[model samples]
Target: MENFKIDVDADGIALITFDVPGRSMNTLTSGVMAEIPQVVERIKTDDAIKGAVLTSGKASGFCAGADLGDMAGGMLAGGSLQEAYDAGWKLNGALRALETCGKPVAAAINGLALGGGLELTLACHYRVVGDSAKIQLGLPEIKVGLFPGGGGTQRLTRLIGVQAAMTAMTAGSSWRPNDAKGAGVVHEVVAAGTEVEAAKAWIKGGGKAVQPWDDKGFKQPGGGPYHPVGIQNFLVGNAMIRKQTYGNYPAATNLMKAVYEGIQVPMDAALRIETRYFIKTLMTPQAQAMIRSLFLSKQELDKGAVRPAGIPQSDPKKVTVIGAGMMGAGIAYVQALAGIETILIDRSQEDADKGKAHVEALLKKRLSRGQLTQEKYDALLASVTATTDYDLIKGSDLVIEAVFENREIKADVTKRAEAQLEGGAVFGSNTSTLPITGLAEASVRPEDFIGIHFFSPVDKMMLVEIILGEKTGEAAIAKSLDYVMKIKKTPIVVNDGRGFYTSRCFGTYVAEGLAMLEEGYAPALIDNLGRATGMPRGPLEMHDDVALDLSVKIAK
Candidate 1:
């Protein structure tokens, strides 16, 4: 039941090891917090312990930080904003206590130190790191629409220079140990598995446990030259934040404000400012919704929440794709890259050759970037077979009809593919708006009919909406899920309907933009509004990229 244990050596140095039970990576939770005070008290009371070194027992990670699931659970249970603030404040208090204790405390970072994990190390007097490439350290709360609720804002500014901390915190950039040491957050970088030993040695050598900010009259390093002039930093930083965040996210601004406000005050007052901002940010509805959607919903979806409860996993190693347009070509390339045997069929040899050439061009680009070796490119290219014959689909485990959106054309391809393939093989339509049930009308076995609606340029987009028609069997859904996962794409399952989810939601964005234009709003203003709303691309820009003709066609 113990999450931590302390052992004191003959030299009066204590090594406090954190090994949370039944977990692969250490995380800060209320349970972990409750135990930490006891360890801190031991170090405080024992006169024999002159210094301490903290390290994790886990090899996978140093710590992943606070459990977002636990936070979401509490929020769903109607926990008040004050309660969350108090919870965070308690952890901050523990970190501060560890910092101010008479004995020195050194942190040995062995792997990822994120959120509360990074905050823990920042509180220590010194830090050493292992040479693992996966050993990254950062406060990434902004990605989920929140700032670091702990003392991350205050400590990071005081440790690294303010400009560096501001960029790191606002961007949520994780750094390697060597980069961290260069930024002054870490003291030394050692070989893998030697971080703890290096930290122990430092503490034993009487390294000062007090942080630079703890010393009176400590001016920040490189103050005059690098500091932004006369609120220029605030203006430029806020503008960039607005551009990137589209004002949909409030965390970035709040974090920037915290670091700016805190850097002007002493450490204690700075921490209070950080806590206030943290509490205020947590109360925002956008933060709550983002945490729920991005964390909890994503977790559930990843665990196959949309799949039928009793359905087992199935891998469709061989797939046949009809047509040689952008969608078909992209799907074929992704499938081949995943090592799946893909049969790409077109109406003519010229079209099939064009599709195969597209795959080769993509592989060549990857090779230029060093993302693919010549050998890998050869192997991936070998996985794809191009043809103009329907008979070539006989061995396909699944056949995706990606031809023109004409219902009769799709129906014809579906009938032909079914006749050529096995009885149990699933038929998927890559149509954006067509109902899977309507498409199933062409199939003799509707249970084998499903919709694998991939967005344009499928290899780049992460979302793949799998539409389950009324007659689609559990095995069909399972196979679709397996295929999407195998190709390293996230699948969102939706009931059979026109434009299922993303497409339907996207229509609203375009409609709003067009409505604004009709109401005498300038195109520039509409574009700005879209950017402010956090759309990756403005509606007008997206309309141009997708072409106005295509939008008209989809609407029809």
Candidate 2:
């Protein structure tokens, strides 16, 4: 009752507003979860409530799903198998009861509805969403090292065929409000403010009070998993999963199992199967580490935990990127997309122009796909200036050197950039292995020098390793943290050293691979087994992706 406020209209329609106190976004915490079954029971017993409409009181979104902080170990903080099962089944059971409570319920989703948020809508007999592309809806639990435990795999697969549901869930992909209708995830897409009324209208106007699965003769779309078509889907799906994840991500594999098997049974039994797999997944070492890193550590770092104290955050509006090769181009692209003015310089005008062309190619693809509007595309394109002129970088608040892994060239560029940089401007080297202190030797302002090592294909990679040199100042650290936040990348700060943290850690993997190779193991075999152990890629593949024998040399 504290989390959910219910108002019954004259027509016996109960409008349940989900507004968790002291939270900008509504997430299913233990308190919220505890209230769920109570709400379901009220809906089932109250004669005044003919139907229910669920909406969020907060403007941020409907719900963000289970609070990852609570979910870190809370779901299976266990005593026995039965206790774990009960813990996982809490939401699943509440949702199941709501769906079969003999009264209609429609979810009025206004903004982002992810993971259990989307799962909540799936349980509703009818769902209406706001007509805005900004409203994202999907099961993104897998991204945070968890699978959707609240009847997601079963209900979503049942609602929108197995292929579409399973594919999006596994990919941690979200759908816009416009696409949700076509995908059958939502019943209506009304104007933003009308979503709640729309849901109530659906219920009061005698919308089917029964869920598709709860009704008689509910044949799953595209047939069950054992059907000839579904059989092929499983065969191909399993092969594709193995090829991609290699049994490393138990959350992904378990989700696949939960969906593949859940589709064959009745709803209640299917939910139990999903819960079992979810609990099993939570117990895995990979999932535990992923939860710690992706949720806890990533959250802390994203909040600037690694940043130096007592310095005000300074997000650079204009940044200078030296070297218009792939790495530099990628950095420029992300900067421009974030509405920052970027000067992308190269040795040749042609290469500088090629860097600009890279941004054009990417934007045009988005524009053609309707993801980017013409106005926004033009604005983003105008944000970057690609040229060979070093003079163009004079007013930049920050400069990042992204040239090759050579010392002399880097030092030369550092001096050239330093000549034009104003006092307080931070200098960053995009080197993977060179120590920040060593790179700072070329700088006139060592305290202002740092290393902002971006991963290859910077636009796609979310991580930016910030290296603090021996003389790196608090202002420089603070500046780098804010700048990475502006571009929406995660940052982890480390002291200057050879290979830094990531590259050094990566070298160990390659060292093992190299030792195995010397022992007469094949590259493909080692790589495959490496991937099977949950690596994003094999050591060789990782080195290849970095455009380097970099890890190999680092390992040596």
Candidate 3:
């Protein structure tokens, strides 16, 4: 009751708003699960209530899914696997009861409805989502080494086709409202403020109380896994899983099993099947480690848990990128995409214009794909000024040097760029190898010098490693984190060192492979083992990706 508020209108529509007090987002905890059955009972018994609508009071999203703290607590409490399995049933049971309570229910999803949140919407007979581009809906539990336990594996497959469902859940893919609707996960996507009314409208329009799979003579979208079409999907899907996961993720394998096995049975039994697989995954050490690193630690870092609280949050209005090569061009494009005025500077107008052309090419591709409006593309392109002028960086709040990775060149650009930066402006070196403290030696304001290492194909890569020099101040770290967030990239803070974090660790993989070759291992065997181990690329392919010549130089 504390987490949920119920109100019944004269039209016999009960609106149950999920608003976890003192929390910015709602999550399915044991307390929330325990409360759901009581609401289900109320909906079923109350003669005046004909149907119900479920929604969130939080502005940020509907729900973030399961409370990780509570989940990890249950799993790590020195309990038996059966105990963990039993605990999962408590949640699975509540969602099941809600679905089959003989009363219609509709979900009014205003924003993100991920993992258990998406599962909750699936349990409803109808779903109405706000037409907000930011709304993220997915069963992303697989990312944390667990599959959906609360009927997600069963219900999603039954709602959408099996192949589509498997792909979405396995990939931890999130979708916008329209995409969710297209996937048959949602019934309607209305204007932003009208989601709640739309849900009420669906229920008032005779929304069914039973799922299609539960109704008499109902058939699954693509028959059961044994059907010819189903066979092809599952066979290829199994091969795909082995190739993609390289059998590294137990959750992915079990999730496919749950969907494959569950769809052949009745709804109730399918839910039980999913819970069994879910608990199997929950008990693995891989799940625990992933939950900590990928979920808990990442969440803490994303919220700026280590940022100095004394320093005000940074909002970088303008940015400057030195050098017009691929890295520098990417930095400028992302800055412009974030609505920041960006200066893309190089040695000549032609070189800088090439960098601008890269941005234009990317914008054109996006426009062709309907990901960007022509007007928006023009504005973003206009925000970036490509030139050779150094004085133009005078107003930049952040100047990131993405020139060649030579110490002398970097030091030279550092002095020239820093001279143009305004008072309080932060300077960053985007070098993957050279130490930030060493780079800071050339800067007049060493306190403002920081390393902001971005990966290749910067627009696609999500991680941005922020290396703090010995002289780097908290304000510099804070501002760099802000700029990384502005570009929608994940930031991991580390001390200044050669190849800071990702690069330092990644280099070892190739080195180890090359070492194996020295030990008389066949080159083909080494590359095959690397790919089969779920690495992004084979050892040789990765070596080629970093460029063989560069790889040899780095190895030395």
Candidate 4:
């Protein structure tokens, strides 16, 4: 009741709004989960209520899915498989009961709906959504090493084709509003405010409560896993999973199993089978670690949990990035995109211009893919002032040097930029090696000196390691964290060290590949085996990605 508010209109349509108290976004917390069944029961028993419309009160999105801070509480951590199964099955039962409650239930999805949120929409007999590209809808639980247990595997496959469902769920893909409707998952797409009206209108216009799977002689799309066409797809799908996951991720394989098996049965029985696989997937230690790191820990870091509370959040009005190569150019691109005036400097006018050119190249790729409007692309491109003028640092609140991994070059850029920089402004060295404390020696404001390490292909990489020099004050740290957050990259604060945090961790991984090479193994074999372990790239390939020159500098 606290998480949901229900109002029955004069036309006998119950509007159920999911609004979790004291939260900016709605999540399936224990209170909200508990109320789902209660609401379904109310819809079933109340004679005056002809149907219901479900929606979220939060503007940021519908539900962000399970509150993993709760570790999904009973669904994964109850000390036994039976306990986890029982807990998950309860919600599945509630969702199933609602769809079969003998009255049409329509979901008025206003914004993002992921994982259980998407599953909730699927359980409804009809779904009407607002037309917004920002509004994403999909089941993305596979990212945190868990598969959907809320009838997602069963229902989505039955609703769409099995092959499409497998691809979406396994990739943890999300889609825009129109894409959802095109995929046959959503019934209607309307203007933003009219989504709720459309949902209510559907039920009033005689929408049926019965699901496709529950209908007599209903057939699943693309047939079951054993059909002639389905058999080839599953055969190919199993091979794809092995290649993609390298047999390391069980959740991906089990999800395929759940869909494969559940697609053949009735809705109720399929829900039970999905729950069983969900429990089996949850029992893995890999899932536990992934949930903690990829979900819980990532959520905390992404929200700036380590940022200094005493200091007010402030993003730099202007940021200067030196070096126009991949890292520097990428940093400037993101900063400019975040609406921060960016100055990209290098040794020459030609070098600085190349940085802006790189931004243009990336923008063009996005434009060709229809990810950016040409006007927006031009505006972003114009925001970066690519030049050789160190004088431009005069008004920059933050100056990041992303040159090579040489101390002298780093020190030179630091001192040159510092001469033009105003008082108390932060200086960030984007070096993976060379301690920040040592680099701070060139700065008049050592307290304002910090390391802002960015990975290669900076636009794609999410992590930004903020290395604290011995004299780096909270203001510099806070400033760096704020800027990182503003740019929408994950930031992790670490004390100064040679090859701090990420580099240190990656060094160990790359070391094994080198060891194999030293043991007379072929470089290609080392890389192939390394990649099979689910690394983004093979060890040698990663070294090349970070640049062989930078790798050598780090080693030295």
Query: Looking at candidate 3, what is the lDDT of residue 247?
Result: 86
TM-score computed on alpha carbons, candidate 2? 0.91
lDDT of 4 by residue, 182-295 (tens): 999898999987889999999999999899888897987887766888777689999999889988899999998898888777888999999899888888888888998988
- Give the alpha-carbon lDDT of every model: 0.84, 0.88, 0.88, 0.89
Give residue 292's lDDT in candidate 4 (0 to 100).
85
lDDT of 1 by residue, 1-556 (tens): 3899799998888888888899888998667877877888888899999889999889888889888777545433446766766665677778888888878999988889999998988888998988766688999998888988778988887776666777898888988877888888888999988887899899878889788888987876535224655255566777888778877788888988887788788777778788878867877898888888887787677767787777767878899999988889999999998889999999998999899889888988888755677898899998888899998898788999899878889999988999997877889999888888998999999998999988878879878889989899988999888888888887898998777888788777888888888999999989988987788877877788877987877767
Estimate, for each residue in 366-402, the C-alpha lDDT of model 2 and write its tens digit.
7887668899999999988988888888888999999
Segments in model 1 whose C-alpha atoms lie over 4 Å from true places: 5-17, 46-51, 72-84, 132-135, 176-185, 204-206, 221-231, 242-248, 315-397, 401-409, 456-460, 485-488
Clashing pairs in model 2? none
lDDT of 3 at 296: 88
Deviation in Å, model 4, residue 465 alpha carbon:
0.4
Per-residue lDDT for 60 in model 3? 92
Output the TM-score of candidate 3: 0.92
**Candidate ordering by lDDT (highest first):** 4, 2, 3, 1
Q: Each candidate: how many clashes?
A: 0, 0, 0, 0
List candidate 3 segments past 4 Å from native.
361-379, 553-556
Give the number of colliding residue pairs in candidate 3.
Answer: 0
Candidate 3 lDDT, 29-67, residue by residue in tens: 878888988988898899999999999999999999999
